[model samples]
Target chain A: MEMITSAQNSKVKNANKLKKKRDRDKTGQALIEGYHLIEEAYQSTVKIKQLFVVDVERLDEELMTYAEEVFEINLKVAESLSGTVTPQGFFAVIEKPVPETTQAKQVLLVDCIQDPGNLGTLIRTADAAGLDLIVLEKGTADPYQDKVLRASQGSVFHIPIITQELSEFIDHFEGNVYGTALENALPYQQIPSQDNFALLLGNEGEGVNADLLNKTTQNLTIPIYGKAESLNVAIAGSIVMYHLKG
Target chain B: MEMITSAQNSKVKNANKLKKKRDRDKTGQALIEGYHLIEEAYQSTVKIKQLFVVDVERLDEELMTYAEEVFEINLKVAESLSGTVTPQGFFAVIEKPVPETTQAKQVLLVDCIQDPGNLGTLIRTADAAGLDLIVLEKGTADPYQDKVLRASQGSVFHIPIITQELSEFIDHFEGNVYGTALENALPYQQIPSQDNFALLLGNEGEGVNADLLNKTTQNLTIPIYGKAESLNVAIAGSIVMYHLKG
Candidate 1:
């Protein structure tokens, strides 16, 4: 077993570079930390390029066989690669899964969601709702970001999430394209659930772009019965996704 | 106008101490940052004990009259008091609202929700769903914490949140008390919506406490259609909340 004790080791340095979007995009790989996510990646169709663990003895037998390479890393290396204050001591470098080419029956189209946590939660909720695909607008937060991967709770590996211009995707999509809005929209309950549909959720402060909303098959809103001005984007998206999944 | 240029000033030091839960409990005050939250506190019935501002001109005129005492603080003092990387240049010391003694028709009972962000999002979602009151179990994250305040997005000011034992509250409650569970639970949609009901949500890792689940009128779950293990606590709680609100 190869041991890498220094944070400056080439393998460790290269893995640390994956923390940035550009590096991940260029290399077609992502760095995932913690045990659960690494296990999820191993179970999924995604390929594990390398594994860095502080305790080789603690690595799952199944995961050890799956990884192409494994290295024993010290606490310093683990800390340097981790985004969190308390590094979980397990990290995996995995190749990004290719997007599915088949047409998805049910989809969740995210438009300009700026917050990584919100974006990640949406992915997890969509996965649980059994949406076939998640289409991210160009400006949405990068799914490979550590905050998103952690927040998704490993569901990112379970689901098919791809980045594409939402407008272009909407142009070709054939379904009940339901956009959420606060005004001039029927209550979400009034809209009948459809087997093939795309639910569009937008930015936190600015909702679905007006041009995009115009293109939607119908606009709907969840009624606000309290003093809160509006629901959080992720929360609102989850309610609509579950309702539509029916 | 009094100007506070030093971070160590008695007033500034005292205000900063409210950041800790122990100090907040002892003083009966919580420190809130950002322009939006400060505005929300001013509009609410809650009393604002002190206001620290980097720029007095930026403060809302209405809020100016609402705060008991306003101090112009330097950037250094503002940064010292803020939890965010970039301070919004506004902070306030507010007394926690007195929980309403009257019985609430629709309530949200949170049991040992440990994550501050999840707790805050639940509070915001409950407020949006128009749940009348939020009852937090003692082990749950402090709603007055900085992370909770930021994640709640000022919904904390709109609703009444009080900490209490789940068992005692359930024993006295008259309405339907719905607890969420993964097994031996009916689909949430199968349950009829009731005007007077309490929705009980539990910790992220643990579902509703076994003892609490045994006491509820019914245990419900949102169906999982994908390979994902389960929905996020906040997401799951939000889905049930909007459904029950109907």
Candidate 2:
């Protein structure tokens, strides 16, 4: 096994750059840390470009066989490539999967969600609700960001998430386009559940873009019976997604 | 207006100490930052022991009038007391509200939820869903922590959250005790929506504790139809809380 003892080693340096969205975009690859996430990626058949592990003997046999290239990295190199305070000692550089082109019957349209944790939890919730795809508006946080990935708990590997102009997507969407809003909207329960639909959730401070809300086939709201101004975007989105899926 | 130019001012130092859970517990006071949260505390009738602001002129007149002691703080003092990168220039040291003595009809029982964000969001969601109260088990994250307070978006002020033993509470409870579990649990929708119920949510990794699960009137689960292993605790809790409140 090749050993990467220096943080400045060419492969280690390149993998470190993949932490940024711009670098991930330019190279079509992203770095993921920890054994659980890497295992999820492997199980999902995402291409593993390279693997870095502190202990070669402890590496999962299947991952060992499947990795295109494996390097034994010291604590220093692992720390450089890790996003977390405590490096998990296992990291992988994997090719971002190509988005499936098929028109999804059930979709979650995320509109400019700025919080990475909320965005990631929404993705995970959508996956659990069996949504076919997640369409993120341009301003939404990058799904591959470390916080987002960790919050998604590897559901990012299980679900298809793509970035696109939400307005254009809604224009072409054939099924029920349910937009959540505080005003001029029916209670979410009043809307009949449908087999094919797109649930639109908006930014935390500002709601669904006005133009996009206008394009939605129906707008709905979960009634706030108490003094809270509103529900968190991820929480609101999850409830409606599950309701729609039913 | 009295000015506090130094971070070492006795009052400023004491307020800073309230940032830690142990100190907050000992003093029965917690420091909350940002304008919105402070306003919420004021509206909730929580006792404000002291108010710290960068500019007295910019402070809301009502908050200024209501605060027991108002101190004008400089940027250095503000930065030292703030939890976020950019300080909002408003801070308050508030006494924890006494738990309401009356029994709540709709309750949220949280068991060992370790994440501050999850715990906070649950509080916010319960408030929005019109749940009467939130009962936290011993191992759950401290609701007064900065991360929890911020994630809660001031909903902590809108609801009563008290820590109590789940087993004892369930034993004396009058209505249905719904424990969320993956095994031997009915689909959440299968249960009839009832006004008086206690919804139990557990840790992120572990489902409801086995002993607690056995004590519930009914164990329920939100269906997961995709490759994702489970729903996030807050998400699952919100869905059920809203359902039971319907």
Output the number of the DockQ-best candidate.
Answer: 2
In model 2, the clashing pairs are none
Candidate 1 lDDT over residue span B1-246, tens digit each: 899999999999999899999999998899999988887787776799899999888988778788899999999999999999999899999998887777888999999999989998988888888888999999899999999998998889888899889899999998999999998899999987779999999888977899999999999999999978898999999999988876
| lDDT tens digits, residue span A1-246, model 1 | 899999999999899999999999999999999988888888886899899999888988888888999999999999999999999899989999987777898999999999999998999998888889998888889999999998888889877888888889999998889999999888999877679999999999999999999999999999988778788899999999988876
Q: How accurate is candidate 1 locally (lDDT)?
A: 0.90
Minimum summed lDDT over a 10-residue window in model 1 chain B is located at: B37-46
Give me the displacement of residue B245 in model 2, in angstroms: 1.7
lDDT of 1 at B190: 91
Candidate 1 lDDT for residue B234: 93
Per-model TM-score versus the true fold: 0.98, 0.98
**Candidate 1 wrong stretches, greater than 4 Å:** none
Candidate 2, residue A107: Cα displacement in angstroms equals: 0.6
Interface RMSD of 1: 1.0
